[model samples]
Target: MMKAGPSQEEIRRHNLGALLRFVHVRGPASRAILAENLGLNRSTIMALTSDLTAAGLVREELPRTPGRRAGRPSLVVRPESTRVYVLAFDVGVDRLTVARVGLGGVILDRREAARGRVAASGGASGAADPNEMVNALAAAARSLVRKAGDEATCVGAALAFPGIVRRSDDQVMFGPNLDVGGMAIGEVLSRRLGLGVPVAVCNDANLGAIAEHERGAGVGVNDLIYLHGDVGVGGGIITGGRLLGGEDGYGGEIGHMVVNPGGRRCACGSRGCLEAEVGERTLLDLAGRQESPDVPGREAVRAVVDAAARGDVVARDALHRVGTWLGRGVADLVNIFNPGMVIFGGTLRDVYLGAAAQIRSEVATGALAASRERVKLRTAALGDDTTLVGAAEFAFADVLADPVQVLARLRGAPASAPVP
Candidate 1:
């Protein structure tokens, strides 16, 4: 038997989601702009906007611009930023960040702390103690939620994890730096936070690409690569305006891409991986700081770059070598993907800033002319918050997709969910 088409109610829900997503990403937009962009008639747009407005997801207002045009002004539809929010968690190698991100892509509050590397007992270095980690994250998230107070609604929570996450279930497949692999961190954190929302977990690099594409330097550029550096390197690739998540959601493991045969051993036990060559340890080792305890956070990477800027030969040379390797790896990706932009983020942002010349030179020599011609290399515009913002976007996905129903579900949540 043939499947039936979508009912009118389903279509309305879709349109509602589309309209909300547009306004959420593009900020306040006029009804006419919404109608034009959504390919909906003016009356339909008005109806949709009215529904969202009544649902407290959006509100219509006069245009902020002064002076009238030839026709009646299209009222602007604005997301209810203050009233709606999500908890965005960024689990980096050096630190953990939790944020209260409002509906209109605004981060209203956040808590960040230096988080030392974790090592699960009786397991390979990457296996995690889920309970301990969740307790820590919950402690910070508690303060954030408390600050949000009673007026706001937290619709969901999302985490940007550094390692490979099994997309189907948000399972951490490998993250040696945090020892979080093979743990149900999402479910654990949800239980700890007791927020009554499923905590969504995804690869950090993928989220970084999403944030940059939507709100950072990659804006307006569809095909782009975002390379993030933490304890190790990670990547998020976007192509034709969509994330290139291969089957099983493990496609963009660019860090493990073998860049140098028989070179340094990677954390994944692979030899000569891009991450092994250009990651934090390699940079510090090249700069002669390998003997020291792994300095917490990006401080170690930033210190090297700072020294390089101060004319320290060792530091400068370290940056140049790492940047070259980074460039070579980038060139290979560029050749394969032919992206319009390549964004350097996390510790890579500092590395890119210090050795931009060397990185550019390597890219020039290694990449095909046609492919390299228009590719823009730049640091993440969101600075330290790229992945954090992306986490918020992920958390907000359900609400943006089906505003009315999502709100209904959230509203239906038991009021006895316990007080903060």
Candidate 2:
């Protein structure tokens, strides 16, 4: 709501905030375009841009991409190079991946560590100790922060887990693979790492969906579903351009959605869950006569996918079977939401190279005519980097909201008098 009479100072600050947000989300913009986009007068744009420049949050540069030559091509304004970078941690069962990201979705560096965890009860289903993994992850994050150098103004981290996440607060409500039912990831990591940055934790699949929607295949669409096909089948739903965290932040657990009345037992203690049916382990089993002694489940599936792409009929058939299951699961989403697109991401998409065509074919055949027309199926364009990038985006948003306060916290400064 617009205030009846906003003071000139307030209006200027509001306009500057809006302009910064636009640049942060959409990258660089020329003064003419920004003025037109914000519907602000040229003088206002000039003033706001100058203030941002003084804050070291915005800068001007010649256009990076080619453009029309109309009177010297005015410089474009963008977030400054010294703006803080977001740390993204994409946690998986067998690997812990990290990326240092800046505004505009640029990844400065990325690395991965082994997922050797101290499991519970000596069962394969149980992953490494949650506390142990968190410690290691925090250390890695600290090292990365140092590596990012002093220019990293603030940090925003999102940990992608295979579990139910609480929406109102970023907590791992439950994660089967981690062998922990409820975990407060945000609180623990913040204390241990002391990076002085806000942390946002969420399900890996949901982040995958976010990454897809923001920069990958689902871009320009308002409503979509992104499915992660890897060690397990997971899903994230976006409706009206927002990630629907649901009542429990577990709304997109489509992998656990029953595809068959009676099927394989899922690790989550359910029978016939989609994850049980067509997860990476299941796909690997169907791909080869027997599991290779030396290869892990994910690698085995990748091998088969490589074989399939090289013209192996049996491997192709296996991939098609997984694709068929994918389509079956997507059909349910279409029936309910009628999203504009369904993006398939993660290891499954990599394994099933032609899987999108198969899912599309089945959806066209099985889904309602209107829903089918509304949805277009495709694989993720960002590949496995989707979750990491999405987490980075989440972090950037968090930092930009209250940069001064966050920076104070990061630098161990006491807050001044509260706003009355």
Candidate 3:
């Protein structure tokens, strides 16, 4: 049986999506630039832009400085960032964040709260209880959404979670350091939010990879890896410009990779996992904080890194040891994926800044010359907000995929309300 190709309508719809996505990611573009980048003729680009502009997804304006060499300057198309937006949520081991992000990847507003047993306000049952976490997130989200102007409309929403997730159903299968497993977090939160939109849930690390590739350090690189470190480590890999999500969307659990067979036990009941060797606990213990009262996470990590910078021998040695194991895991990933870049996010960003020397030495010794030669290693360009920005990107995906139809439908729908 022969499969039919796309109809003219389908082709136009796809092109509409592609054109909108280009400008949303790359910012404003002239008609000529859009046509050139999208590989479409000027007329075709004009038609698509017209459709988008009519749908209120984009608006055209004069460029600030039209070069004299140009014959009548072409108008520049810019995303209607203020009017079109999405709600982005980040569920982490130690905190919760909700943001209103616009079409052009600009964060308009946000709310945040501390979570986990380590947080000062974390009484014990923190993110583990889905209901409690959902309540906190919903309250913050409502406050954020209430501030939106009447002209503003949310197109979609998504949650970034730090755990193994089944993206197809928004299910958290496992969380070694977190405890929100086996819960329909998105569905539960969706009802509470009353945005009349389903909240998509995905692995935090994967979103980190997507954000980094699109707007962070990995931008313009087709092959890259993003390692997110918090209470534990999770990874996102981009191979050939696409995420290497496995058959079940759990492909990037890079932290649990066994770097030492008979070493310290891990939270996932495994010994010598990369995260176990280099994660929060390892760094804290090595820095000799045996009975610290505060939670041992990013703040504690920063304290250690700061101490190392001040020439504290204990902190320096601790970072060195962890960086050695981190390098081994990074080397293995380099050998396997040969990514052009490897970015460290979350707490690892601090660790990397503190121990780049040790990690590079280990990678030099462990990774093959060809694989490691051009692979740049660095901290996340988006800083600690890497995963949170990723959530915004995820929320914007569908709208970016079909801007005209999605915006039309979203605007036509009744306004969302808080569930009383």
Candidate 4:
């Protein structure tokens, strides 16, 4: 069997990579800042930075702000021209977004497709094969690679599905929302593209959580949750400064928590689940079905909030309903995980903003005092780019931190090894 923990060399590389990532995300820093940010001494930072500079992974720039005590400011160190890029893909129920992101989380370019069941058709003019969607994604990625114009050394593609993902094998175990099951997306994408670079697959909400933790509102705090209220409900969790994907990578499926006993039925054959009550479809049904003005659920929630903003009773009632269900779900999470922060990401961010106070109020009242004390609820900072950036970071760290995983990708084998 492969080793259980990082090797000596792997530990060194991992620490160095973590140091660089800290600088990349937090911006230019002096030696003091670097040491403070990464908990490394000046000597350690100097040694690792020297190695990084020689490898063209980092550069020093003039400080943007002068110190209060110094005549001349110390040089600020940051990532350099040698950067990696990722083709980040977010596959939702009705849309697919592909973005070209740099190593430092900059979105260099992007493309989006407004696809629904048609995406299932896979551009075949008729059929909706999961492989067909993968093929379309491959084509989109190829176009992006060509457009990146020489800055692309390797393409790290991250696809976020709306269901369970076996990270160990990179297999999309189940995506009932997209009508897919047991598909090895990472393997097929690598074959389709012929690039032999690292490809990753993750639960959409988990990625959202990771994105937020790394670049969005969850920064600087561990024990956080990212609850996604969109077409379907999904969640991502972080604990102890690391993502909390269980042995099967299905640990963060919080939407399936049964909150109501006699509620609506869900795709998972359960009734009264949190997702059944607060999912996009639930809101659409509440707003009335087709021939009654087809308002997208998220849009409907927004309209309800907008009307409420103008003091409309009906809109106010709808928002209250949403807030109540959202609160119950959050209360349960707070009791269970006691996260340090809880972010409202996904389509809900826009709608939730109008009723955020009410939602937090409910959570604060309903959850335990200790749990509530530790949590600070907020909206995601990186918005939709969170997943894409997290995906790129995943690939960058995976490859550099674990030479074995890197060798696996180069040898066209599955990255079954533990992520460093």
Candidate 5:
């Protein structure tokens, strides 16, 4: 038998979700603009906007300026930033950040804490205790939720982990920087919050790519690559304006790409991986500085950059070496993906700014002439907030996918209930 097509209700729901997603990503738009962009009639656009407004996901208001030749200014539909919020968490090797982000990508409030390594017992490994890390993150998230006031509604939550995350069940598969591999972090966080909203766990680099594509340097660029640096290197690839999550969501582990054969060993049990060749620890070691208990890794990297700015030959040389290796790795990616842009984020942003000349020189020599000319290499525009914003976006994915149903659930109403 031939398959049945979607019903009218299903089509309505899909159009509603598409309209909300467009406004959420592209900001406020007039009804005519929405109709044009979504290829829907004016009446259908009005219906969708009205439903979204009643669901507390959007609001319509008169344009700020009156049109010179119009009967009345077109109403602008905007995401309801004040009423709805998403909690975003960024888990790094040495730090944890929790943020309450509103619908329009505004960070309403945030909290941060240091993540110190768990004390080693007799012959015990010094990796961070997964339980302790979860507890600290839960506490921070709870604090932010409380600070948001009881009147505010949390639509969803997402955690950006510095590791490989299984998309099917939000299981942490591998965390070289964290000790939470195989942990059900999303389930644990949801239980800790005691909130009905489900929490999501995703790779930090993936989130970074989302944030960059939506609001940072990758904006308007369809195909791009985002490389994030923390304790280890990670990557996010965007193709055709969508994140390129491989099957099982385990793709984009660029750090493991071999850069130096038979060189230094990596934490992932690989020799001469890209991360091993150019990660923060290697940079510190090359700068003749040891990781201090008091100084954060990012701060330590900044110290090296600061020293280089002050004409320190050792610091400059260290950055150059790392940049050269980074460039070589990037060259391979360019030849393979041929992206229009390559963004360096996190600590790599500072590293790129410090050694742009060297990186560019290596790319010039290593990458194909046509590919090199088409790609733009730059630092992250969102600064330290890229992953946080990405977490928020990930949290909103469900809501954006099924706007009417998600809103009904949030409102404690039946899916078929009419907007009141």
Candidate 6:
């Protein structure tokens, strides 16, 4: 007997989702454009748009730029940014951000807090206490949600954590920066918020890469590498327009790659790791700045950059040394991945802009000539919001994957009940 094929209803739902996703990613587009892009007839596109509009996932508006000699302006379809939202969280070693983002990657509202990297006993380590971090994050999330008002429908929540997150469950496998290893972060945050929605935890750098690829420096580039810096360095790799997450989602831990043998101790209990050699702490220490709560991590990095700009020999020399190490790491990555672009984000953006010459020199010397000649090095265009935007994109994954079913579930659920 022949196998059964998908029902017509299934096909319609799939087409609806495809249209919604295209509009969401590519921005508001006309029905004619949508029909042409999706290879559907005008009638099919019209039906899909009607269904989506009735579902409240999208809105049809007159085009902002109408064509000349137009009779009636064609309506453009756009994601309903005000009504539907997603909670995006970024957990860094010294910073925490929570944002309410709308369907079309619009940031509706946001809240941010600076976290102290001291142990409960006031030790000088840069690792955040797990309990304290989680509590603070929960509080921030609550505040953001409350501020978003009850009328908004939250589709999902995604957290960008600076660590190796287990794919099986959103567990923190190893986080030298946040000190939250072996914790079920997603489950805890989900229960705390009581939103009844999926709370996803992903590597911070991976999210940064996603945000950059979609809207920032990597926009038009298929193969790219994103390197993020906070208390420790992390990397995100993208190949062929897809995130290259390894088995169990622990792939982009480039910070832990051994660069120098027996150089400095790393939080991962390894000696001479890339992060150990060139992370924020090392850069500050080399620049002769004392680590203290009085100076925030971002501020300290800024101080170094400022000093370098003022021609401070100590700061300039320190940045040069760090840049050389950073370049060595980049050279290895270039040889391995042969990416078309490499984006330096977070604190690394400052470092790269400050020491671009040294970094370029090392890459030119160490990387393969062919790969080096074709690659472009750029700073993150999204500035500090790259990871936060990435978190928003991550939250939208479920909604985009099965738009019809997910929206149906949302519409059917009680208004008082959080999205499940």
Best by TM-score: 3
- Ranking of models by TM-score: 3, 6, 5, 1, 2, 4
**For candidate 3, lDDT tens digit of each residue in 13-75?**
999999999988999999989999999999999999999999888999987787687487778
Q: Evaluate residue 77 in candidate 3 and report its C-alpha lDDT on the 0 to 100 scale.
A: 97
Report lDDT (CA) for all predictions. 0.87, 0.75, 0.87, 0.71, 0.87, 0.87
Clashes of each: 0, 2, 0, 3, 0, 0
* Candidate number with the higher lDDT (1 or 2): 1
Evaluated against the true structure, the overall lDDT of model 5 is 0.87
Better of 2 and 4 by TM-score: 2
The alpha-carbon lDDT assigned to residue 280 of candidate 3 equals 85
RMSD of each: 2.9, 4.4, 2.3, 5.3, 4.0, 2.5
lDDT of 2 by residue, 241-317 (tens): 99987777889899899887688888788887888878876776677645432455566677777888889888888
lDDT of 6 at 118: 68
- Give the TM-score comparing model 5 with the true structure, all chains together: 0.93
Each model's TM-score?
0.93, 0.88, 0.95, 0.84, 0.93, 0.94
Q: Which ten residues in a row have the lowest lDDT in candidate 4?
A: 118-127
Better of 2 and 3 by lDDT: 3
Candidate 4 C-alpha lDDT tens digits along 55-91:
5556777776656884777777776523556677777
TM-score of 6: 0.94
For candidate 3, give the lDDT. 0.87
- Expressed as tens digits, the lDDT of each residue in 53-142 for candidate 1 is 888899888777854568777678999998899999998866778899999899998888765554323333321455556766888888
- Which lDDT tens digits does candidate 6 get at residues 1-420? 998999999889789879988887789999999999999999999999998888889989987777797498888999998878889999877778989999888898888888767642347554355766678778877787787777667789999999889888888888766667477888777778877677999999999999999989998899999999988899999999999988899987889988888989998898989899889999989999887676778779988988998999999999999999999999999999999999999999999998898899999999999988899999999999999999999999887777767877866776443322
What TM value does model 1 have? 0.93
